[model samples]
Target: MKKLLLAAALMLAAATARAEDNVVKVNAPPESAVAGETAPAKASTIDCADTLGVSRVAEVDTAGGGEYGEQYPPKPLLEKGEVVLTFDDGPHPEFTRQILDALAAQCTKATFFHVGRMLKEFPDVARQVQAEGHTVGTHTHTHRNLGGASMGQAEQQIESAINIAEATLPNGVAPFFRFPYLSDPQRVRDYLAKRNIAVFGIDVDSFDWRWRKPEKVMHNVLSGLDKTGRGIILFHDIHGSTAKAIPALLAELKARGYKVVHLVPKSRIETVAVAEPTAAPAPRRRARRHRRSKR
Candidate 1:
Protein backbone atom coordinates (compact mmCIF):
# COMPACT_ATOMS: atom_id res chain seq x y z
CA MET A 1 0.00 0.00 0.00
CA LYS A 2 2.91 2.36 0.84
CA LYS A 3 4.51 1.73 -2.59
CA LEU A 4 1.24 2.28 -4.39
CA LEU A 5 0.57 5.59 -2.53
CA LEU A 6 4.06 6.86 -3.31
CA ALA A 7 3.60 6.06 -7.03
CA ALA A 8 0.26 7.88 -7.09
CA ALA A 9 1.78 10.94 -5.42
CA LEU A 10 4.53 11.07 -8.06
CA MET A 11 1.95 10.90 -10.84
CA LEU A 12 -0.05 13.74 -9.28
CA ALA A 13 3.09 15.93 -9.06
CA ALA A 14 3.92 15.25 -12.71
CA ALA A 15 0.40 16.19 -13.78
CA THR A 16 0.54 19.42 -11.76
CA ALA A 17 3.85 20.43 -13.35
CA ARG A 18 2.46 19.79 -16.82
CA ALA A 19 -0.56 21.92 -16.02
CA GLU A 20 1.65 24.79 -14.89
CA ASP A 21 3.64 24.62 -18.09
CA ASN A 22 0.46 24.82 -20.12
CA VAL A 23 -0.61 27.93 -18.21
CA VAL A 24 2.68 29.66 -18.89
CA LYS A 25 2.41 28.84 -22.56
CA VAL A 26 -0.98 30.52 -22.77
CA ASN A 27 0.10 33.69 -20.98
CA ALA A 28 2.46 36.38 -22.23
CA PRO A 29 6.03 36.28 -20.99
CA PRO A 30 6.88 38.40 -17.96
CA GLU A 31 8.25 41.89 -18.65
CA SER A 32 11.76 40.79 -17.74
CA ALA A 33 11.65 38.09 -20.42
CA VAL A 34 10.87 40.68 -23.11
CA ALA A 35 13.79 42.93 -22.26
CA GLY A 36 16.53 42.63 -24.89
CA GLU A 37 14.56 39.91 -26.64
CA THR A 38 14.01 40.52 -30.34
CA ALA A 39 11.26 38.00 -31.07
CA PRO A 40 9.34 37.03 -27.95
CA ALA A 41 6.19 35.00 -28.48
CA LYS A 42 3.24 37.36 -28.94
CA ALA A 43 -0.03 36.62 -27.21
CA SER A 44 -2.91 36.53 -29.68
CA THR A 45 -4.96 39.63 -28.96
CA ILE A 46 -7.37 39.36 -31.89
CA ASP A 47 -9.71 36.48 -32.63
CA CYS A 48 -10.14 36.08 -36.40
CA ALA A 49 -11.57 32.60 -36.06
CA ASP A 50 -15.06 33.69 -37.20
CA THR A 51 -14.74 35.34 -40.63
CA LEU A 52 -13.56 38.81 -39.68
CA GLY A 53 -10.97 37.42 -42.10
CA VAL A 54 -7.74 38.55 -40.44
CA SER A 55 -4.58 36.45 -40.42
CA ARG A 56 -1.09 37.22 -39.06
CA VAL A 57 1.80 36.45 -41.34
CA ALA A 58 5.47 35.75 -40.50
CA GLU A 59 7.50 38.60 -38.93
CA VAL A 60 9.74 40.30 -41.48
CA ASP A 61 12.63 42.79 -41.27
CA THR A 62 13.47 44.54 -44.55
CA ALA A 63 16.58 46.51 -45.55
CA GLY A 64 17.99 47.99 -48.76
CA GLY A 65 16.40 50.35 -51.26
CA GLY A 66 14.25 49.15 -54.14
CA GLU A 67 13.52 50.19 -57.73
CA TYR A 68 10.87 52.71 -56.74
CA GLY A 69 13.48 54.79 -54.89
CA GLU A 70 14.42 53.85 -51.29
CA GLN A 71 10.95 52.38 -50.77
CA TYR A 72 10.81 48.60 -50.76
CA PRO A 73 8.36 45.95 -49.64
CA PRO A 74 9.17 43.14 -47.14
CA LYS A 75 12.16 40.97 -47.99
CA PRO A 76 10.33 37.70 -48.62
CA LEU A 77 7.74 39.83 -50.44
CA LEU A 78 4.01 39.59 -49.79
CA GLU A 79 1.63 37.19 -51.43
CA LYS A 80 -1.41 38.51 -53.32
CA GLY A 81 -3.84 40.35 -51.06
CA GLU A 82 -1.43 40.71 -48.11
CA VAL A 83 -1.22 44.21 -46.57
CA VAL A 84 1.10 45.68 -43.99
CA LEU A 85 -0.59 48.65 -42.26
CA THR A 86 1.63 51.58 -41.24
CA PHE A 87 0.70 54.89 -39.60
CA ASP A 88 2.86 57.96 -39.35
CA ASP A 89 3.13 61.50 -37.81
CA GLY A 90 1.11 60.73 -34.73
CA PRO A 91 0.32 59.97 -31.20
CA HIS A 92 -2.25 62.72 -31.77
CA PRO A 93 -4.06 63.05 -28.46
CA GLU A 94 -7.50 62.79 -29.97
CA PHE A 95 -7.02 60.38 -32.85
CA THR A 96 -4.27 57.94 -31.82
CA ARG A 97 -6.37 56.44 -29.04
CA GLN A 98 -9.39 56.08 -31.31
CA ILE A 99 -7.19 54.36 -33.91
CA LEU A 100 -5.80 52.04 -31.25
CA ASP A 101 -9.26 51.11 -30.07
CA ALA A 102 -10.42 50.37 -33.58
CA LEU A 103 -7.36 48.21 -34.20
CA ALA A 104 -7.88 46.32 -30.93
CA ALA A 105 -11.51 45.72 -31.82
CA GLN A 106 -10.34 44.00 -34.98
CA CYS A 107 -7.29 42.38 -33.30
CA THR A 108 -5.12 44.06 -35.90
CA LYS A 109 -1.53 45.21 -35.33
CA ALA A 110 0.31 47.89 -37.27
CA THR A 111 3.71 49.59 -37.39
CA PHE A 112 3.77 53.25 -36.39
CA PHE A 113 6.66 55.52 -37.47
CA HIS A 114 6.28 58.35 -34.99
CA VAL A 115 7.84 61.77 -35.04
CA GLY A 116 10.26 61.96 -32.07
CA ARG A 117 8.73 65.11 -30.62
CA MET A 118 5.29 63.53 -30.65
CA LEU A 119 6.53 60.51 -28.73
CA LYS A 120 8.11 62.76 -26.08
CA GLU A 121 4.91 64.74 -25.69
CA PHE A 122 2.73 61.63 -25.61
CA PRO A 123 4.74 59.00 -23.75
CA ASP A 124 1.63 57.33 -22.38
CA VAL A 125 0.19 56.90 -25.85
CA ALA A 126 3.56 55.59 -27.00
CA ARG A 127 3.66 53.09 -24.13
CA GLN A 128 0.13 52.04 -24.91
CA VAL A 129 1.23 51.33 -28.47
CA GLN A 130 4.06 49.04 -27.35
CA ALA A 131 1.98 47.37 -24.63
CA GLU A 132 -0.58 46.39 -27.23
CA GLY A 133 2.09 44.58 -29.32
CA HIS A 134 2.61 46.89 -32.33
CA THR A 135 6.02 47.76 -33.75
CA VAL A 136 7.18 51.39 -33.22
CA GLY A 137 9.85 53.33 -35.11
CA THR A 138 11.10 56.92 -35.53
CA HIS A 139 10.03 59.45 -38.17
CA THR A 140 12.64 62.20 -37.47
CA HIS A 141 12.82 64.68 -34.60
CA THR A 142 10.67 67.45 -36.00
CA HIS A 143 9.34 65.86 -39.15
CA ARG A 144 11.90 68.00 -40.94
CA ASN A 145 12.62 67.65 -44.63
CA LEU A 146 15.72 65.53 -44.18
CA GLY A 147 16.26 65.06 -47.89
CA GLY A 148 16.77 68.80 -48.37
CA ALA A 149 18.71 69.45 -45.18
CA SER A 150 22.47 69.42 -44.72
CA MET A 151 24.03 66.11 -43.69
CA GLY A 152 24.50 67.34 -40.09
CA GLN A 153 20.90 68.49 -39.83
CA ALA A 154 19.61 65.23 -41.28
CA GLU A 155 21.75 63.16 -38.90
CA GLN A 156 20.52 65.13 -35.89
CA GLN A 157 16.91 64.70 -36.99
CA ILE A 158 17.32 60.94 -37.41
CA GLU A 159 19.44 60.24 -34.32
CA SER A 160 17.52 62.43 -31.90
CA ALA A 161 14.19 61.07 -33.09
CA ILE A 162 15.40 57.53 -32.53
CA ASN A 163 16.71 58.42 -29.06
CA ILE A 164 13.44 60.01 -28.02
CA ALA A 165 11.44 57.02 -29.27
CA GLU A 166 13.71 54.50 -27.49
CA ALA A 167 13.45 56.49 -24.25
CA THR A 168 9.66 56.49 -24.48
CA LEU A 169 9.14 52.85 -25.43
CA PRO A 170 9.05 50.06 -22.79
CA ASN A 171 9.98 47.55 -25.44
CA GLY A 172 12.93 48.73 -27.55
CA VAL A 173 12.08 50.48 -30.84
CA ALA A 174 11.97 48.41 -34.01
CA PRO A 175 14.92 49.03 -36.38
CA PHE A 176 12.76 50.60 -39.07
CA PHE A 177 12.36 54.12 -40.47
CA ARG A 178 10.26 56.09 -42.96
CA PHE A 179 11.23 59.35 -44.63
CA PRO A 180 8.93 62.30 -44.44
CA TYR A 181 7.10 62.98 -47.74
CA LEU A 182 8.56 59.68 -49.00
CA SER A 183 11.76 61.52 -49.86
CA ASP A 184 15.01 59.68 -49.02
CA PRO A 185 18.46 61.04 -49.83
CA GLN A 186 21.13 58.60 -50.95
CA ARG A 187 23.49 59.79 -48.21
CA VAL A 188 20.87 59.24 -45.52
CA ARG A 189 20.21 55.81 -47.00
CA ASP A 190 23.91 54.91 -46.62
CA TYR A 191 23.91 56.09 -43.02
CA LEU A 192 20.89 53.90 -42.16
CA ALA A 193 22.37 50.91 -43.94
CA LYS A 194 25.59 51.07 -41.92
CA ARG A 195 23.61 51.26 -38.68
CA ASN A 196 21.44 48.33 -39.85
CA ILE A 197 18.27 50.42 -39.69
CA ALA A 198 15.81 49.71 -42.50
CA VAL A 199 14.15 52.63 -44.33
CA PHE A 200 10.48 52.14 -45.29
CA GLY A 201 8.61 53.74 -48.18
CA ILE A 202 4.94 53.19 -48.76
CA ASP A 203 3.55 51.19 -51.65
CA VAL A 204 0.11 52.74 -51.11
CA ASP A 205 -0.44 56.25 -49.75
CA SER A 206 -3.96 56.58 -48.28
CA PHE A 207 -3.90 60.37 -48.80
CA ASP A 208 -5.82 60.48 -45.56
CA TRP A 209 -4.10 63.68 -44.56
CA ARG A 210 -5.52 65.50 -47.53
CA TRP A 211 -8.94 63.91 -47.44
CA ARG A 212 -10.98 64.88 -44.39
CA LYS A 213 -14.05 62.87 -45.31
CA PRO A 214 -13.87 59.30 -44.00
CA GLU A 215 -15.66 57.91 -47.04
CA LYS A 216 -13.29 59.61 -49.43
CA VAL A 217 -10.22 58.54 -47.45
CA MET A 218 -11.47 54.97 -47.45
CA HIS A 219 -12.06 55.12 -51.17
CA ASN A 220 -8.56 56.47 -51.87
CA VAL A 221 -6.92 53.68 -49.82
CA LEU A 222 -8.85 50.86 -51.43
CA SER A 223 -8.28 52.31 -54.89
CA GLY A 224 -4.54 52.57 -54.22
CA LEU A 225 -4.55 48.97 -53.04
CA ASP A 226 -6.33 47.97 -56.23
CA LYS A 227 -3.45 49.51 -58.16
CA THR A 228 -0.53 48.13 -56.12
CA GLY A 229 -1.94 44.68 -55.35
CA ARG A 230 0.01 44.31 -52.05
CA GLY A 231 2.53 46.24 -49.93
CA ILE A 232 2.60 48.59 -46.96
CA ILE A 233 -0.40 50.93 -46.79
CA LEU A 234 0.16 54.34 -45.19
CA PHE A 235 -2.12 56.53 -43.12
CA HIS A 236 -1.72 59.36 -40.65
CA ASP A 237 -3.15 58.77 -37.19
CA ILE A 238 -3.10 62.53 -36.63
CA HIS A 239 -5.96 62.95 -39.05
CA GLY A 240 -9.45 62.65 -37.56
CA SER A 241 -10.68 61.39 -40.89
CA THR A 242 -8.19 58.53 -40.95
CA ALA A 243 -9.12 57.49 -37.44
CA LYS A 244 -12.79 57.63 -38.38
CA ALA A 245 -12.16 55.61 -41.51
CA ILE A 246 -10.25 52.77 -39.83
CA PRO A 247 -13.20 50.57 -38.86
CA ALA A 248 -14.86 50.80 -42.26
CA LEU A 249 -11.50 50.33 -43.93
CA LEU A 250 -10.83 47.22 -41.86
CA ALA A 251 -14.21 45.83 -42.81
CA GLU A 252 -13.54 46.51 -46.46
CA LEU A 253 -10.23 44.66 -46.17
CA LYS A 254 -11.96 41.75 -44.49
CA ALA A 255 -14.66 41.65 -47.15
CA ARG A 256 -11.97 41.71 -49.82
CA GLY A 257 -10.02 38.82 -48.17
CA TYR A 258 -6.90 40.84 -47.27
CA LYS A 259 -4.44 39.53 -44.64
CA VAL A 260 -2.36 41.69 -42.27
CA VAL A 261 1.37 41.09 -41.92
CA HIS A 262 2.95 42.21 -38.65
CA LEU A 263 6.60 43.21 -38.89
CA VAL A 264 9.20 42.77 -36.11
CA PRO A 265 12.92 43.32 -36.47
CA LYS A 266 14.69 39.97 -36.65
CA SER A 267 17.71 41.53 -34.87
CA ARG A 268 18.17 44.67 -32.81
CA ILE A 269 20.12 47.52 -34.43
CA GLU A 270 23.71 47.70 -33.27
CA THR A 271 25.56 50.92 -32.52
CA VAL A 272 27.81 52.07 -35.34
CA ALA A 273 30.65 54.51 -36.03
CA VAL A 274 29.92 58.11 -37.05
CA ALA A 275 28.33 58.42 -40.47
CA GLU A 276 30.54 59.36 -43.39
CA PRO A 277 29.88 62.62 -45.23
CA THR A 278 28.35 62.24 -48.66
CA ALA A 279 27.48 65.10 -50.97
CA ALA A 280 23.83 66.00 -50.75
CA PRO A 281 21.83 64.98 -53.77
CA ALA A 282 20.40 67.69 -56.00
CA PRO A 283 17.27 69.29 -54.59
CA ARG A 284 14.03 67.94 -55.98
CA ARG A 285 10.67 69.69 -56.02
CA ARG A 286 9.25 69.58 -52.49
CA ALA A 287 6.08 67.57 -52.09
CA ARG A 288 3.00 69.35 -50.73
CA ARG A 289 3.18 69.22 -46.95
CA HIS A 290 0.84 67.28 -44.69
CA ARG A 291 3.03 67.70 -41.57
CA ARG A 292 3.12 71.49 -41.73
CA SER A 293 0.32 71.92 -39.23
CA LYS A 294 2.33 70.34 -36.44
CA ARG A 295 5.53 72.23 -37.20
Candidate 2:
Protein backbone atom coordinates (compact mmCIF):
# COMPACT_ATOMS: atom_id res chain seq x y z
CA MET A 1 0.00 0.00 0.00
CA LYS A 2 2.87 2.41 0.85
CA LYS A 3 4.59 1.71 -2.50
CA LEU A 4 1.35 2.21 -4.42
CA LEU A 5 0.72 5.52 -2.66
CA LEU A 6 4.25 6.70 -3.47
CA ALA A 7 3.76 5.98 -7.19
CA ALA A 8 0.46 7.93 -7.23
CA ALA A 9 2.12 10.87 -5.49
CA LEU A 10 4.88 10.97 -8.08
CA MET A 11 2.30 10.97 -10.88
CA LEU A 12 0.51 13.92 -9.28
CA ALA A 13 3.80 15.78 -8.95
CA ALA A 14 4.67 15.16 -12.57
CA ALA A 15 1.34 16.49 -13.80
CA THR A 16 1.61 19.60 -11.63
CA ALA A 17 5.10 20.32 -12.91
CA ARG A 18 4.01 19.95 -16.51
CA ALA A 19 1.09 22.31 -15.90
CA GLU A 20 3.49 24.84 -14.37
CA ASP A 21 5.85 24.66 -17.33
CA ASN A 22 3.04 25.40 -19.75
CA VAL A 23 2.10 28.75 -18.21
CA VAL A 24 3.27 31.96 -19.95
CA LYS A 25 5.16 34.06 -17.45
CA VAL A 26 4.80 37.83 -17.53
CA ASN A 27 7.36 40.13 -15.88
CA ALA A 28 6.00 41.84 -12.85
CA PRO A 29 6.61 45.52 -12.16
CA PRO A 30 8.96 46.26 -9.27
CA GLU A 31 7.42 47.20 -5.96
CA SER A 32 8.36 50.43 -4.24
CA ALA A 33 7.15 52.42 -1.30
CA VAL A 34 5.88 54.36 -4.30
CA ALA A 35 2.17 54.76 -4.66
CA GLY A 36 -0.14 53.23 -7.29
CA GLU A 37 1.45 50.01 -8.54
CA THR A 38 0.40 46.44 -9.03
CA ALA A 39 2.57 43.99 -7.16
CA PRO A 40 4.56 41.60 -9.32
CA ALA A 41 2.31 38.96 -10.81
CA LYS A 42 3.26 35.30 -10.64
CA ALA A 43 3.18 32.76 -13.46
CA SER A 44 -0.29 32.08 -12.18
CA THR A 45 -1.40 35.48 -13.54
CA ILE A 46 -1.36 34.02 -17.05
CA ASP A 47 -4.14 31.84 -18.29
CA CYS A 48 -1.66 29.64 -20.13
CA ALA A 49 -4.21 28.25 -22.55
CA ASP A 50 -5.33 31.60 -23.89
CA THR A 51 -1.98 33.41 -24.21
CA LEU A 52 -0.53 31.31 -27.03
CA GLY A 53 -1.32 34.34 -29.13
CA VAL A 54 1.28 36.36 -27.17
CA SER A 55 3.85 33.78 -26.20
CA ARG A 56 7.40 34.97 -26.96
CA VAL A 57 9.41 32.46 -24.95
CA ALA A 58 8.00 29.15 -26.16
CA GLU A 59 8.82 27.55 -29.50
CA VAL A 60 5.93 28.54 -31.73
CA ASP A 61 5.23 26.68 -34.95
CA THR A 62 6.91 28.86 -37.56
CA ALA A 63 5.94 29.39 -41.18
CA GLY A 64 6.60 26.38 -43.42
CA GLY A 65 6.97 22.82 -42.14
CA GLY A 66 9.83 23.70 -39.84
CA GLU A 67 10.30 24.94 -36.28
CA TYR A 68 11.32 28.50 -35.32
CA GLY A 69 13.21 28.67 -38.62
CA GLU A 70 15.45 31.36 -40.04
CA GLN A 71 12.75 33.99 -39.68
CA TYR A 72 10.83 33.99 -36.42
CA PRO A 73 8.57 36.50 -34.73
CA PRO A 74 10.03 39.09 -32.34
CA LYS A 75 10.51 37.95 -28.81
CA PRO A 76 7.10 38.54 -27.25
CA LEU A 77 8.54 39.54 -23.87
CA LEU A 78 11.56 38.87 -21.71
CA GLU A 79 11.31 35.73 -19.65
CA LYS A 80 9.63 37.41 -16.68
CA GLY A 81 12.22 40.15 -16.89
CA GLU A 82 11.52 42.01 -20.15
CA VAL A 83 9.70 45.16 -21.17
CA VAL A 84 9.55 46.31 -24.80
CA LEU A 85 9.04 50.05 -25.34
CA THR A 86 8.28 51.01 -28.96
CA PHE A 87 8.24 54.53 -30.39
CA ASP A 88 6.70 55.52 -33.70
CA ASP A 89 6.68 58.52 -36.12
CA GLY A 90 10.18 59.47 -35.18
CA PRO A 91 13.72 60.40 -35.88
CA HIS A 92 12.36 63.86 -35.25
CA PRO A 93 15.67 65.43 -34.36
CA GLU A 94 14.58 67.12 -31.17
CA PHE A 95 12.17 64.52 -29.84
CA THR A 96 14.16 61.49 -30.87
CA ARG A 97 17.18 62.93 -29.11
CA GLN A 98 15.29 63.41 -25.91
CA ILE A 99 13.88 59.90 -26.17
CA LEU A 100 17.34 58.48 -26.72
CA ASP A 101 18.76 60.38 -23.80
CA ALA A 102 16.07 58.79 -21.72
CA LEU A 103 17.03 55.29 -22.83
CA ALA A 104 20.74 55.98 -22.46
CA ALA A 105 20.27 56.86 -18.85
CA GLN A 106 18.49 53.61 -18.14
CA CYS A 107 20.59 51.47 -20.49
CA THR A 108 17.25 50.40 -21.90
CA LYS A 109 16.73 49.39 -25.50
CA ALA A 110 13.58 50.22 -27.47
CA THR A 111 12.26 49.84 -31.02
CA PHE A 112 11.80 52.99 -33.06
CA PHE A 113 9.45 52.90 -36.08
CA HIS A 114 10.96 55.50 -38.38
CA VAL A 115 9.16 57.48 -41.06
CA GLY A 116 11.13 57.57 -44.33
CA ARG A 117 10.94 61.32 -44.70
CA MET A 118 11.93 61.77 -41.11
CA LEU A 119 14.83 59.36 -41.48
CA LYS A 120 16.05 61.28 -44.51
CA GLU A 121 15.93 64.53 -42.63
CA PHE A 122 17.41 63.18 -39.42
CA PRO A 123 19.83 60.50 -40.51
CA ASP A 124 22.06 61.36 -37.59
CA VAL A 125 19.35 60.62 -35.06
CA ALA A 126 18.50 57.36 -36.81
CA ARG A 127 22.11 56.36 -36.69
CA GLN A 128 22.22 57.28 -33.05
CA VAL A 129 19.33 54.92 -32.33
CA GLN A 130 21.20 51.94 -33.78
CA ALA A 131 24.38 53.05 -32.08
CA GLU A 132 22.61 53.21 -28.76
CA GLY A 133 21.39 49.60 -29.14
CA HIS A 134 17.76 50.26 -30.15
CA THR A 135 16.09 48.51 -33.08
CA VAL A 136 14.95 50.50 -36.12
CA GLY A 137 11.97 49.71 -38.37
CA THR A 138 10.19 51.32 -41.29
CA HIS A 139 6.95 53.18 -40.76
CA THR A 140 6.43 53.59 -44.53
CA HIS A 141 7.70 56.12 -47.11
CA THR A 142 4.79 58.39 -46.42
CA HIS A 143 2.73 57.86 -43.32
CA ARG A 144 -0.29 57.05 -45.49
CA ASN A 145 -3.44 55.62 -44.12
CA LEU A 146 -3.05 52.04 -45.30
CA GLY A 147 -6.74 51.44 -44.79
CA GLY A 148 -7.29 53.85 -47.67
CA ALA A 149 -4.56 52.40 -49.91
CA SER A 150 -4.72 49.62 -52.51
CA MET A 151 -2.50 46.55 -52.73
CA GLY A 152 0.01 48.16 -55.10
CA GLN A 153 -0.02 51.34 -53.06
CA ALA A 154 0.61 49.44 -49.86
CA GLU A 155 3.48 47.49 -51.34
CA GLN A 156 5.06 50.61 -52.75
CA GLN A 157 4.78 52.51 -49.51
CA ILE A 158 6.36 49.73 -47.51
CA GLU A 159 8.96 48.60 -50.01
CA SER A 160 10.12 52.09 -50.84
CA ALA A 161 10.72 52.94 -47.20
CA ILE A 162 12.54 49.67 -46.74
CA ASN A 163 14.84 50.56 -49.64
CA ILE A 164 15.56 53.99 -48.27
CA ALA A 165 16.15 52.66 -44.78
CA GLU A 166 18.43 49.97 -46.14
CA ALA A 167 20.49 52.56 -47.94
CA THR A 168 20.74 54.79 -44.92
CA LEU A 169 21.20 52.17 -42.22
CA PRO A 170 24.31 50.19 -41.46
CA ASN A 171 25.08 47.30 -43.87
CA GLY A 172 22.18 48.39 -46.12
CA VAL A 173 19.83 46.25 -44.07
CA ALA A 174 16.27 47.27 -43.28
CA PRO A 175 14.50 44.38 -41.61
CA PHE A 176 10.95 45.21 -40.51
CA PHE A 177 8.10 47.42 -41.71
CA ARG A 178 5.14 48.79 -39.78
CA PHE A 179 2.01 50.11 -41.49
CA PRO A 180 1.53 53.83 -41.01
CA TYR A 181 -1.71 53.12 -39.32
CA LEU A 182 -2.17 49.81 -37.60
CA SER A 183 -4.30 48.49 -40.41
CA ASP A 184 -4.29 44.76 -41.04
CA PRO A 185 -5.99 42.85 -43.82
CA GLN A 186 -5.61 39.21 -44.66
CA ARG A 187 -4.17 40.27 -47.98
CA VAL A 188 -1.68 42.55 -46.25
CA ARG A 189 -0.69 39.88 -43.76
CA ASP A 190 -0.37 37.35 -46.60
CA TYR A 191 1.87 39.72 -48.54
CA LEU A 192 4.21 40.18 -45.60
CA ALA A 193 4.12 36.50 -44.73
CA LYS A 194 5.49 35.74 -48.17
CA ARG A 195 8.59 37.70 -47.17
CA ASN A 196 8.72 36.04 -43.73
CA ILE A 197 8.33 39.38 -41.91
CA ALA A 198 6.25 39.34 -38.80
CA VAL A 199 3.76 42.15 -38.37
CA PHE A 200 4.75 44.11 -35.25
CA GLY A 201 1.66 45.34 -33.48
CA ILE A 202 1.18 47.31 -30.29
CA ASP A 203 -0.50 45.76 -27.29
CA VAL A 204 -0.96 49.13 -25.58
CA ASP A 205 -1.21 52.74 -26.72
CA SER A 206 -0.75 55.62 -24.21
CA PHE A 207 -2.94 58.00 -26.27
CA ASP A 208 -0.25 60.62 -25.87
CA TRP A 209 -1.90 62.30 -28.84
CA ARG A 210 -3.89 64.49 -26.52
CA TRP A 211 -1.31 66.99 -25.35
CA ARG A 212 2.13 68.47 -25.21
CA LYS A 213 1.61 68.23 -21.50
CA PRO A 214 4.17 65.69 -20.33
CA GLU A 215 2.24 64.97 -17.20
CA LYS A 216 -0.91 63.83 -18.99
CA VAL A 217 0.85 61.42 -21.30
CA MET A 218 3.14 60.34 -18.51
CA HIS A 219 0.23 59.67 -16.22
CA ASN A 220 -1.59 57.66 -18.87
CA VAL A 221 1.47 55.57 -19.68
CA LEU A 222 2.66 54.86 -16.13
CA SER A 223 -0.78 53.73 -15.01
CA GLY A 224 -1.35 51.50 -18.01
CA LEU A 225 2.19 50.12 -17.93
CA ASP A 226 1.68 48.96 -14.40
CA LYS A 227 -0.69 46.35 -15.73
CA THR A 228 0.78 45.55 -19.15
CA GLY A 229 4.53 45.28 -18.60
CA ARG A 230 5.80 42.72 -21.10
CA GLY A 231 4.46 43.64 -24.55
CA ILE A 232 4.88 46.70 -26.74
CA ILE A 233 3.88 50.07 -25.33
CA LEU A 234 3.35 52.76 -27.99
CA PHE A 235 4.27 56.42 -27.73
CA HIS A 236 4.96 58.98 -30.44
CA ASP A 237 8.40 60.50 -30.59
CA ILE A 238 7.55 63.20 -33.13
CA HIS A 239 6.03 66.09 -31.27
CA GLY A 240 7.73 68.51 -28.88
CA SER A 241 5.52 67.23 -26.12
CA THR A 242 6.61 63.64 -26.50
CA ALA A 243 10.22 64.72 -26.63
CA LYS A 244 9.83 66.60 -23.41
CA ALA A 245 8.04 63.63 -21.95
CA ILE A 246 10.83 61.07 -22.42
CA PRO A 247 12.86 61.92 -19.39
CA ALA A 248 9.91 61.63 -17.13
CA LEU A 249 8.84 58.55 -19.00
CA LEU A 250 12.12 56.83 -18.42
CA ALA A 251 12.31 58.00 -14.85
CA GLU A 252 8.85 56.70 -14.14
CA LEU A 253 9.65 53.45 -15.91
CA LYS A 254 12.65 52.99 -13.64
CA ALA A 255 10.80 54.03 -10.54
CA ARG A 256 8.13 51.50 -11.36
CA GLY A 257 10.84 48.83 -11.50
CA TYR A 258 10.61 47.71 -15.15
CA LYS A 259 13.75 46.23 -16.66
CA VAL A 260 14.28 48.55 -19.59
CA VAL A 261 15.22 46.12 -22.33
CA HIS A 262 16.33 47.16 -25.78
CA LEU A 263 13.96 45.16 -27.94
CA VAL A 264 15.69 43.61 -30.97
CA PRO A 265 14.34 40.64 -32.87
CA LYS A 266 16.59 37.60 -32.62
CA SER A 267 15.81 36.66 -36.23
CA ARG A 268 14.50 39.49 -38.44
CA ILE A 269 13.33 43.01 -37.70
CA GLU A 270 9.55 42.81 -37.34
CA THR A 271 7.52 46.02 -37.67
CA VAL A 272 3.95 46.46 -36.57
CA ALA A 273 1.57 49.41 -36.81
CA VAL A 274 -0.96 49.61 -34.04
CA ALA A 275 -3.93 51.25 -35.74
CA GLU A 276 -7.67 51.40 -36.27
CA PRO A 277 -9.15 52.51 -39.59
CA THR A 278 -10.32 56.03 -40.16
CA ALA A 279 -13.43 55.23 -42.15
CA ALA A 280 -14.08 58.66 -43.54
CA PRO A 281 -11.78 61.39 -44.80
CA ALA A 282 -14.28 64.07 -43.96
CA PRO A 283 -13.91 66.02 -40.74
CA ARG A 284 -16.22 64.85 -37.97
CA ARG A 285 -16.91 61.75 -40.06
CA ARG A 286 -16.55 58.36 -38.45
CA ALA A 287 -15.70 55.16 -40.24
CA ARG A 288 -18.78 53.04 -40.12
CA ARG A 289 -18.32 50.24 -37.67
CA HIS A 290 -18.95 48.08 -40.69
CA ARG A 291 -16.57 45.16 -40.72
CA ARG A 292 -13.96 45.83 -43.33
CA SER A 293 -12.95 42.47 -44.72
CA LYS A 294 -9.30 41.69 -45.53
CA ARG A 295 -7.81 39.42 -48.12
The per-model lDDT (C-alpha) reads 0.66, 0.54
Q: Write the per-residue lDDT of candidate 1 for residues 182-271, one digit (tens) a residue.
A: 766888988887666877777777777666899988898899889877878888999898899998898888788887766556455443
Off by over 4 Å in 2: 1-81, 172-174, 267-295
Clashes of 1: 0
Off by over 4 Å in 1: 1-47, 51-54, 62-75, 271-295
For candidate 2, the per-residue lDDT at 182 reads 64
Q: List the candidates' TM-scores in order.
A: 0.75, 0.65
> In terms of lDDT, which candidate is strongest?
1
For model 2, which pairs clash? 109-262, 182-275, 187-295, 200-271, 200-272, 279-287
